[model samples]
Target chain A: MAEFSLIETIRERCAVARDDVRLGIGDDGAVLAVPIGHELVVSTDTLVAGVHFPLQTAPFDIGWKALAVNLSDLAAMGANPAWATLALTLPSADAPWVEKFADGFAALAREHQLALVGGDTTRGPLSITITVFGFVPAGAAVTRAGAKAGDWICVTGTLGDAAAGLACVLACEDGADELIGRLNRPAPRIAAGLLLREVASAAIDISDGLLADLGHICARSGVGAEVCVDDLPMSEAFGEYADAPTRQRLQLAGGDDYELCFSVQPDRAPALLWDLAQSGCAATRIGQIVVGREIMLTDDSGAQIEMPLRGWEHFA
Target chain B: MAEFSLIETIRERCAVARDDVRLGIGDDGAVLAVPIGHELVVSTDTLVAGVHFPLQTAPFDIGWKALAVNLSDLAAMGANPAWATLALTLPSADAPWVEKFADGFAALAREHQLALVGGDTTRGPLSITITVFGFVPAGAAVTRAGAKAGDWICVTGTLGDAAAGLACVLACEDGADELIGRLNRPAPRIAAGLLLREVASAAIDISDGLLADLGHICARSGVGAEVCVDDLPMSEAFGEYADAPTRQRLQLAGGDDYELCFSVQPDRAPALLWDLAQSGCAATRIGQIVVGREIMLTDDSGAQIEMPLRGWEHFA
Candidate 1:
């Protein structure tokens, strides 16, 4: 098939409602309207084969993960996703493959209420880059630098399901089907993020492991944190893996969780958890920011535990 | 180098004014603000080596062309280029090559008053994907479906220079440096697009050849067009190449022109051209809309020109 035909097929398959999209995939670009009083939050992420994902992963999962990760970014900022543009490069225009990928992509996009605004389809090694946009009220979005020294650090949902999921997949472990699914389709905490917008002093989604991501908040806010190991939230599925120490390590440093880790004033922390539970998000008080530059883990007796501070590095 | 270090380098090198950039690089994603009263125009283009450009093209030209092409999309919408996010895939991080590419990209972006808002770098065969955003007045964007029959077709600047340049490079013609530069760094006609927005009934950037791109406008608008061969604009540089017949063939049906093709009411066409010329854009009326479904070209003696309607098609 020709390139134009491929684009035409994609346009038809990815259609949600072309009305909100002033221009879709057929034009030079797309035009979109930003409703009054809402600011646009723009974010771009590129997932390359063999780097961002394993080569043998299903195409649908690849497509779902590509858009989901970007949506996570918008969610971290407490913005409502509105539009997305995809720049796709593939070894060839495999029609069946593209159809499945687009179906997977459009399903997630439609579920999130995002319009497929515009995109480029090209020839190259498989890579998918999505630039996502969301709307947030001016000055209401959260950032990493707003954490205060006295703020309580909280996290939504399980901390290390995705990390444990990867381990299960790598080991090909039996009875680990649910764990592997978490790695493939980690859910972004959109509702919790929206609910925490008014209360979060600082926020970031856990993609680079909880410890490393929290370190970002620490470096930006010029404060240290003491995380209570006993307060860590781990999925029951993770317990089927190695031992307690291994699970703790995964919770602290294993990445790709897609859960929202945030800081809130001490007064708002308790109510926020109840609010999060109502929204189907489990909340846990992981730590507290303090006046220092070190990130430490304390046990039940407030004794610091010695462990390797390893995090996922893209090109380590 | 690690991906985090690579991103830190980009964050420093691609820095522009930070007033409208709520967040730059190095986060899960960047946050940016689109100013009030302006609708956002978004576009993404991917340039793969051996596909978008000649294999031996200069790094600087490649960088310039990648961003310039996306800007042309914004220009076609009568939008002002504002923010851009680049996703670069390279075999490896070649230090000198990366520096030169960044310099070229920064220069073009700075000249257009566009900020390098955010980006990602990854390892792969050399390719660059840029997602660009522009701002236009709400509900004032120029789209392809707005043209009406009986409207005059006008194109800003000359077409065919880039095509001729590509030919020169392919034929290894000596002393065709200027032609080669036209292919390498074609101006996007952004200012002209903004000027034509109010007057143009419909418009599209001439990328997939005039016939093919205009066909897109016609198909979307449910109209047809009649182009006059005698009125087609060719640069003096293009005239120096193949005979008039061949020149008309290649120029009219060649891709990568990047000129703006637009429709205007015949009554408003003359004034639009005059206004465009005053603003330093050399526009020429090349055709008119018709009441049928086919694109036809007539020569000076009112004889129909029989020509193949060939244009660029990927994956053909």
Candidate 2:
């Protein structure tokens, strides 16, 4: 098969209907009609073989994670995704492998009603780049720069599960595979993110460990953060893997958890928490923003805790 | 160095201010305000090392050609270039090499007044994937499906220069370095494309040789075409090549031209030529669209020309 045929195969299986998609998947370029009173949110992410995922990972999981990461970016901005373009590179053309990959991608795309609009397929080292385009009402998108000194910090769902999942892959651990599921097929908190846009003062999705990702919000918003270490959200699966030190390390410095971490004013914290609960979203308040530049941690005793702030470094 | 710092380095050097770019190269993903009454145009292209270019080519040229290819796609749609996101993968963190790459990218971006909105950097085999967004007036965009049987086929700029340039590199032909420039640095017909949108009924940018690219237009338009061999525009430098047979092969099957091939009504041909002349763009009428499905070729003597239709096939 030629490059053109491979692209057609992926496109046919991935097509989803949307009225706003003026053109999709076959042309020099795609034409999209942006609705009035909305601004487009676009972000691109690339996932490379071995570097971004385990070499033993299934092809379906790879395709799922590739689009999941870019959608995570859109979710962080409270943008409703509408369309996406993919640039796929492969070492060789494998028909069955590509069909499963397309199936994985289409499954997630259908959930969010995102249409595959344009793409390019080429022969090279295996890698996937996806650019997702979404829209948020004008002046309504949440940004990392909106956090204030007196805001309360909270996180949705649980953390440290994905990183713990990575550990299972590294050690070839079997039996309990929930963490591995979290690592390979992360559920992007799109609903929680869209809800937080109205009540939260600032927002971000955690990808590179809690500390490193939170530090970004502080650096951009010109504020400090104080996290109550004891208040860290942990799943039962993560808790069973290790003792205090290991759990703490995983929660604080482990990465690849695509959960939303956001902030709200103290006065509205009650209302936000109530609304999130009503929406069936489990959220926990774990920290507060301060006027200083420090990102400090504290134990139940109210004393400072010291630890390394490490995340996944692509070029370390 | 880490991915974040490398992104920051490229961001600092490639920044070009535009009012529409609400955020550029920082935060989670860049945000933009699209102009009202316009439709967004998007396209993506990926270039892999040792697959798209020579292994020994300069880093600067690679970056330039990477952005140039996607820009050509947008040009084919007759859209005004706006924002672009880059996904760059590199095997190692080489600071000076990256800087030069960014310099080459920024130079072309500044020329078109395009803003570098968002991107991702990663550690992997070298590849660059660029997704460019542009805008065209609603309902004014020219598509490949608009050609009629009577439309005259036209092309902008000379053919076969870039292919001959590649041959020079393969043979280490030092005396003819101009073709090498054509191979390494292709000039996309942005202005001519924008002009042709008002005059031409169907348009496509020549990337994978004349026959292949034009075949795309014909396939989409449900029509056929015939090229008068003697009418093909050739650069003076290309005339110094081997003999007629070699020249004919290079003209028909050679790829990487990066020019514009389009169809206009026969009645409007003189007007288009007049406009192109005023704009200092060299274009020629090569043939006419037909009612059948074959892409045929004939010489000045009115004899049928027979040659292989082979071009750059990625999977072949």
Candidate 3:
């Protein structure tokens, strides 16, 4: 069979297209029509070998995390993912690896209902980049510049699990597989974000550590924030791999948390909290948006706490 | 400055936005409002180290070609270029290389009036993947399945220049810079495609060589093709870089042409040719869609000629 036949084999068994998808694989390009009154949201992420993940990492995890990160970006914008395209570079045409990778990718894509539209595969060092598209109504999508003073700052689920997982990998700690799995398989807060779209004024995903990502929202909205160091959420599973101080450090400075961090107006916070509770979402009031241009962390006794301005810096 | 900051620097310097761009950089996701009566077209491509190009290849060419190839896909679909997201991976944070890559990318992006909505930069063996988006009115875009028996097959510009350029590079042949440039900076036939949107019945970009790509259109449209070997638009520059047999090989199977291979109905052929001439487009009828299931080639005297299938293949 020719290369096109090979592509046909892969595309047939890959991400299934939805009815709304006007076109799919085996064309010059895929065509999709967004529903009326809905806006298309797009984001792209690239994962490189040796830098983003160890060479020993599973191909399935790599595919899953690649899509998950882009989905997290969609969640941060309060958009529902509808489509995605993957650009994969590999060392060779390995069948077993492709099967596992497709399994991981299809599982996450099905869960999120994201149809795979088009993609390209080429010979190169192992790398995966995914470009995802989502949809939301006009003027209703959450943004980074919509936050205001006196807004309740909230975070979905927990933070630092991925960070803790990375730490376990770096330290070669025992029972690190669980943490590594968390690092490899991040859960994008799709439902929570869609639910909070109306109530939240601004939102972002925590991938560059809580402080850094929060700073982005604050800077964009021209408001400061005060995150209570004590209010931060963590999994007890983290403690199995880290000490208290290490866990604190990991939670504050480690990156790759795909949870949504959002700001809700003080007046709407009560109803939002109730709705979140009803949905069984573990939403936490981490702090409040302040008037000034500085991010401060407060202790359990309401005392100010100091920490380094450290996070994942690509250049460094 | 950090690598992320470097990316931010490029983003700020090349800040491109239009009303259709509902969201740009600095947001978790980009939102686009496709104009009414239009459908979105999407394509992605990936280039890997030592596979797509030589390691010593200039970073600028790499950047240009990455976006150019995707633009060709949109062109083949008879779509108007709109937005693109880049996923770039590198071994290290090389400042000068990054600057040049951005420079080449921004220059081409500005020329095409395409917006850099969003992308991600990460560490790994050097590779670049770009996903491009375009818009074509509903029911108007050309596709591979529109070709019909007795339709005239046409191609824009020349072929084999880029492939011969690669041969020159592999042989360390000097004075083939023009051919190499063609290889590195293949022009997507956007203008020709736009002009042919209403006239052409089926189309595809010549990436994996003319025969292979046209074979795709034939299989999809359920039509055979009779290409005149004498009519193949082989660039004179190709001969300057390779010998007779080598030139014929490049013309037959060497890839990276980025030209539009389209089919036009017999009656509409005259009007289309006139329009292309008026637009100063270099296009010619190279073949005819036949009623059989084979891609046959004929000489000037109408004798069938046998040729090798030599396009780029992932599983070959």
Candidate 4:
């Protein structure tokens, strides 16, 4: 098949009815209306085969994760998903693979009502680059530089599940479908993010582990953090599969959770959590922002705990 | 260096002061205020190392061409450039190469006052994906679906130069600096596009040869076209380096020209040409849109001319 034919297939499968999109897939550039009083939030992410995921990962999962990761960035910014463009480089025009990939992408896009506006497909090694655009009310975006020293640090959803999931996949373990699912199709916390924007002072998505990502908050907000190790949330599957040390390590340092780690003032924490729960999202308070510019982990008795692993860096 | 530090390096280098940019770099996403009464125009393009360009192409040229091509899409839409996000996949973190690449990208960005908002760096074979966002007045953006059968076909600048440049490079021919530069750094027709927005019936940027790009307009506008082969523009360098057959082949089916091919009504063509010339962009009337859905090329005497080469199609 030619590139245009593949693009036509993707367009047919990923089409969504959106009023704000003036022009969608078949244009040199997509024209979109930014509703009055809204600011645009943009983020780009690239996932390469073997480097970002296992070479054997299903095409559907690859498509899901590619869009999911970019959506996660929008979620971290407290923006509502609107549209996205995909730049896919493939070894060849594998029709079956493209079909499955489009199916995976379309499924997630439908859930959020996000339209695929425009994209480019080229011949090369297998890789997917997705750039997501979202919107927030003007001057209403929650960035990573607004945390105060006395703010309470909170996170949406469980931590370390994706890490545990990766471990399971690597070890060829059995009966770990839940963990594997977490790894393959981690959900973006868009709802939680929208709610958090009303109360959270600082926010970031955990793609490079809790410590590393929170460290970004620290550096950006000029504040430190103290995480209570016992307060870290873990899934039932993770609890059963990981030993104490492994759990601690993965919970603290594991990447690809796609959970929002944010800071809220102590006064607003209860109300925010209640609102999140009402919105069908469970959130947990795990730490507090402190004066020092370092990330510290503490146990129940408040003793500092050593980090087990460093965060994943693309090039180190 | 780690990814974040490298990002910091890029942020420091590509940073441009813009009032509309609420937050850029160091965040989960970039936030920008879209101007009121305007709509957003978005486009994406990806360039792989060997597939899109010769492997030995300079990083500077790679970066320049990547952004240039995306900007071309915005140009085709008659949108003014504003912001762009880059997703760069590199085999290794060669700081010098990155520095040069950023320099090239920054040079063009500075010319148009386009901001580098956010980007991703990953480990993979060399590839660059750029998503550019521009703005046009509501309902004023030119699209490919608006051409009428009586419109006159026009193209900005010259053709065949880039293809001839590629041929020179592939043959290791010396002293073809002009041709090679055309291949490495094709200028996007931003100014022409902005002007054509008022006069052109439909528009597209010529990247995949004029015939193919014009074919897109035909497919979208539901009209056909006839190109006068003798009227096709050729640069001095292209004329010097190519024989009659080579020139005809390259000019008729060359890729990477990054020029605007648009359609305008006959009554508006003269004024539009004068306006374009005043704006320092030379445009040529190459043909006319016709009633049918086929692209035909003819000599000056109106005799049908056969095309020498096919347009480049990915994954064909």
Candidate 5:
């Protein structure tokens, strides 16, 4: 098993036909034709064996999650994913593991119509770095600095499921496969992100917990947010927990939910809601932008609620 | 040191103002405004501590070489270096090590006027993955599939220096500091690559030895090459290695030179050589493309030389 042959295996496995990819793998670099009048969007993410996922996680899950996280970034920008390059490091050249990894990666790639442009494979401790490229209409990208005071804040899909899934995987909780699935393959809200481009003032994907990710929009847009605790969407899997505290912790502060968190102008909230509903994206109105420079969480009675937990912080 | 602060340190340290960079080093991803009528070229490479370099190599050299290898890919395609995103993995976040790594990376980046884009850092075994984005004129990129039978073959800078440097480093050969430098910090023949776009029938960078990389061009272009061993470029660092076998081994089969290998029509050779000379890139006419279906190497008196060494291969 030579390095060149391994790359050929990956190329054969991940092959997808896309006109935009003028050149794919097997070149010094990938040549891409960015369509006229379009702006390119790119992002990279690295996932470690034990730090980002459990060391025992399957190769398929690892490959899927690596691409998923990077796609989440493109989704945040309201960009259509076009291509990806993977820089994979492995402890050894295990044929079955590599084949399964490519299968998982290719399955999701086909689903999103993402072409594998190029990549590198090396011998090292197991880790995967995926750099995804996408395109959006010029000046149409929804960045983090556009939310204004009085904008309505919303989130797509449920929060806390992936966090609870992580807990389940780590504790070996019985019959919590649903939660574990969420952890292994949290879907990026790509459609929802594109829909929001027409109405939302700011957008970001929830990688860190809801509070932390929303706070990013606030900090960047120079506006504060007021989120209602009861409005936080927790999946049914979280109901299995005995106490509300665990659910709240996962919902507010646990990370790895690839859902879209966005803000819309007050005047456009109706249109945003209608469009999302029409597109079958389960979006929930959770909060509003305020003039103050702090993100405040409150109960239904208008009383301020204390922060339930600390956000996930790398290298803290 | 939280991840955010660490990113800020990298952002500040690696900051180089470039007009093409609309935004850099923060947010969900970096934004760039590609010039009109240009295509985007991208490449990714990962360097592991033990697999790609000596485990005890200095942090500065590691950072410089990591970006250097990726730049070589862009050079092969005649693409100008524009922006880069790094996905760095480390076992721990040591501040001193991080700073030195940033310093080394930034120095090379600034030299090429490449901006630091978005990146992700994780705790894991030490490895660095860099994805570089460059731009070339629409439909004007030098590709590996364009060489014809009459094209003259050439290579830039001296070959064998990097490989000789590797040997010295491994054997602790004295007074070979220059060779070690050549191994650790290869200058990508970027200017030469750009100049060859108008004249070269095909171009590639010498990373995995001359024969392997040229084999790429020949394989893609459906051509063969014939080389004169006496005409191969060898650096003065290998003067002590008087044996023809070792010289040929280091000159023809050693990897990591980061020099541009190109093929131009015999009629255009004069112009190509003049252009390279004006750009301060030392290029030599090593051989010519032939009609036969093999890359043949012969001595000055016409006897064929056996391929004495195999190129570096991962997972071999």
Candidate 6:
């Protein structure tokens, strides 16, 4: 069967030898040994062609982003990635496309020592569903429910780059290579998450823009947040392409920024930020958790800013 | 957002509170504790609309079969299902459709005590990707690589019912409700698998027909198999609809059975069959593992019976 052969192609490309994987591909299921005293963190995400990404997006980027999004979920939980399963639905058996996709997926899996343990490839419209498995210390997983009202909210890396990249793609504009790269390959903040587990009060991956994802943290923690719109970090490419208003809108409401939005005690914020920067994951404080139920966007003069949209909702 | 509210609907319906799940839905990821001294068994499967099922099939049936197929994988590995993550992609957020789907998913999940841990709902052509997590004792998983030359090859339940059910659906035939039910709702042989772990040398779930799935056990074990065509089990409904040759062809090459095809030592086969019967799963001995690389079928008089096709292959 071509399915078996295609799976063999993926197995060969993603053949990472791990001691914990007792059984890998070509079985009913993958058998994994989770270390004692560790909890398993599992996350699943699906990327649909033309919906999650543009129809003309390269297969390589689709594969990378599919797994990257799921990995970001694990990163938000302060887990070390270990294994993943891919359920790929393709329109046809385009061999070159599959090979490039596997290459992209394998490259990222190799970087984190994550094994492609098992997967299903089927005939259908183009979509990729990736489920990632990682491990964290028992009872030490950073959740979205641990923030206090007085904690400071911080985010890793610059925002709005991916959104700007999407804009470039849509407008068929050229020469925004760095912004495009950000959209194609958003890094999963695994290392920073591991460090944050020790000090952060709560954490979430910023997939649905900074404001929307921070709202998730606030809702789960039963607190509100006051974001200083002027403090949002933006890359040079994003600044060069989008105007001031567009920048604020994109950074605050853009989806697909795979950064970490987390809350930390004000007393430990400076040290934690320094540690994150030393680990190559620079973070900036953008807001404060407050004792209310509504997320407030404040300008430099402490005036409230009215945002049109919160985030991307699938059905809305 | 509506996505969160939709997830809340699913969460309320499929909520099976298990102690091992520290954090479930509404989080970036789910944190789960694997029991001490057990290995995690993971499997993933995706069901694409019109490819995995008829487009007119009920949402409830689609929901049940999606999770059931994945559960069958865990059953093949002799693992007890514990948690599952669902990634559902739909054209729109039809609240009623989602509610029915969740009910069907929750019904089977509750029977096996499986918890829906975390999931993602996205806009796309309809599809459901489920990754199931289960546990088996260390070194005790029944894999397809353990069948010895003298092992007795057996199968649980009858074969070809699902294919016949699909035929009825396609032809718009009536009074084949039982067969159609079999096609829509396959009972994963979880209990029988647990018992087989004690005696079966190797096992695989018959998703891709009896011959193809048993062939997997043969290929993995470096052995061959010989099946007696007359001994293939068939339900009364299957016999009523299919003539002898049709019955033989359908049972041998039809897919989506969700039954277990296992090989056990001849000495232990009788006792294992009895135990499985006591557990309400009947077993039928149809073949024997042999020392070669080819799968052969023989009639009652030992005459070779040729099969036109091996099994269903995606993108074939």
TM-score of each: 0.95, 0.98, 0.96, 0.99, 0.97, 0.99
The alpha-carbon lDDT assigned to residue B104 of candidate 2 equals 83
lDDT of 2 by residue, B1-316 (tens): 6788799888988888999887677666677888999999999999998888888889888888888898998888888899899999999999988998998888888889989999999989999999999998887777898888989999988888888988888787787777888887777677887888777999988888899888989999999999998989898899886687888778777888888899999999889978877888778999999998888999988788888776777887
Instruction: Select the stronger candidate by lDDT from 4 and 5.
Output: 4
Candidate 3, position B193, lDDT: 84
The alpha-carbon lDDT assigned to residue B23 of candidate 4 equals 93
lDDT of 2 by residue, A1-316 (tens): 6788889889998989999888777788999998999888888999998988898889889888888988988888888899999999998889888988998898899889999999889999899999999888887788898889889999988889998899989999995599999898887777777888878888888888889888888988999999999999999999898788888888888888888889899999988888777888788999999998888999988899998767667887
Candidate 3: residue A145 Cα off by (Å): 1.8
Give fnat of each prediction, in order: 0.72, 0.81, 0.86, 0.98, 0.81, 0.89
Chain B TM-score (model 2 vs. true structure): 0.97
Q: lDDT tens digits, residues B1-316, model 6?
A: 3787889999999999899999988889999999999999999999999989999989889889999999999999999999999999998899999999999999999999999999899998999999999999998999999999989999999999999999999999999999999999999999998998868999999998887899899999999999999999999999899789988989999988899999999999999999989999999999899999889999999998887668888978
Per-residue lDDT tens digits for candidate 5, residues A220-281, read 99999999988887777777754787787788888898999999987888888888888888
Winner on DockQ (3 vs 5): 5
How many backbone clashes does every candidate have? 0, 0, 0, 0, 0, 0
Supply the global lDDT for candidate 4: 0.91
DockQ (C-alpha) of model 6? 0.80
Q: Rank the candidates by DockQ, best first.
A: 4, 2, 6, 5, 3, 1
Listing every candidate in turn, what is its Cα RMSD in Å to the true structure after a full C-alpha superposition?
2.1, 1.2, 1.9, 1.0, 1.6, 1.0
True contacts kept of 2: 0.81
Docking class of 2: high
- Model 5 chain B weakest 10-residue run by lDDT: B22-31
Question: lDDT of all predictions, in order shown?
Answer: 0.83, 0.87, 0.84, 0.91, 0.87, 0.92
- For residues A127-196, write the lDDT of model 6, one tens digit per residue: 9999999999999999999899989989999999999999999999999999989999888999999999
Better of 4 and 5 by TM-score: 4
Residue runs of model 6 more than 4 Å from their true location after superposition:
none
Candidate 2 residue spans exceeding 4 A from truth? none
Clashes of 4: 0
Docking class of 5: medium
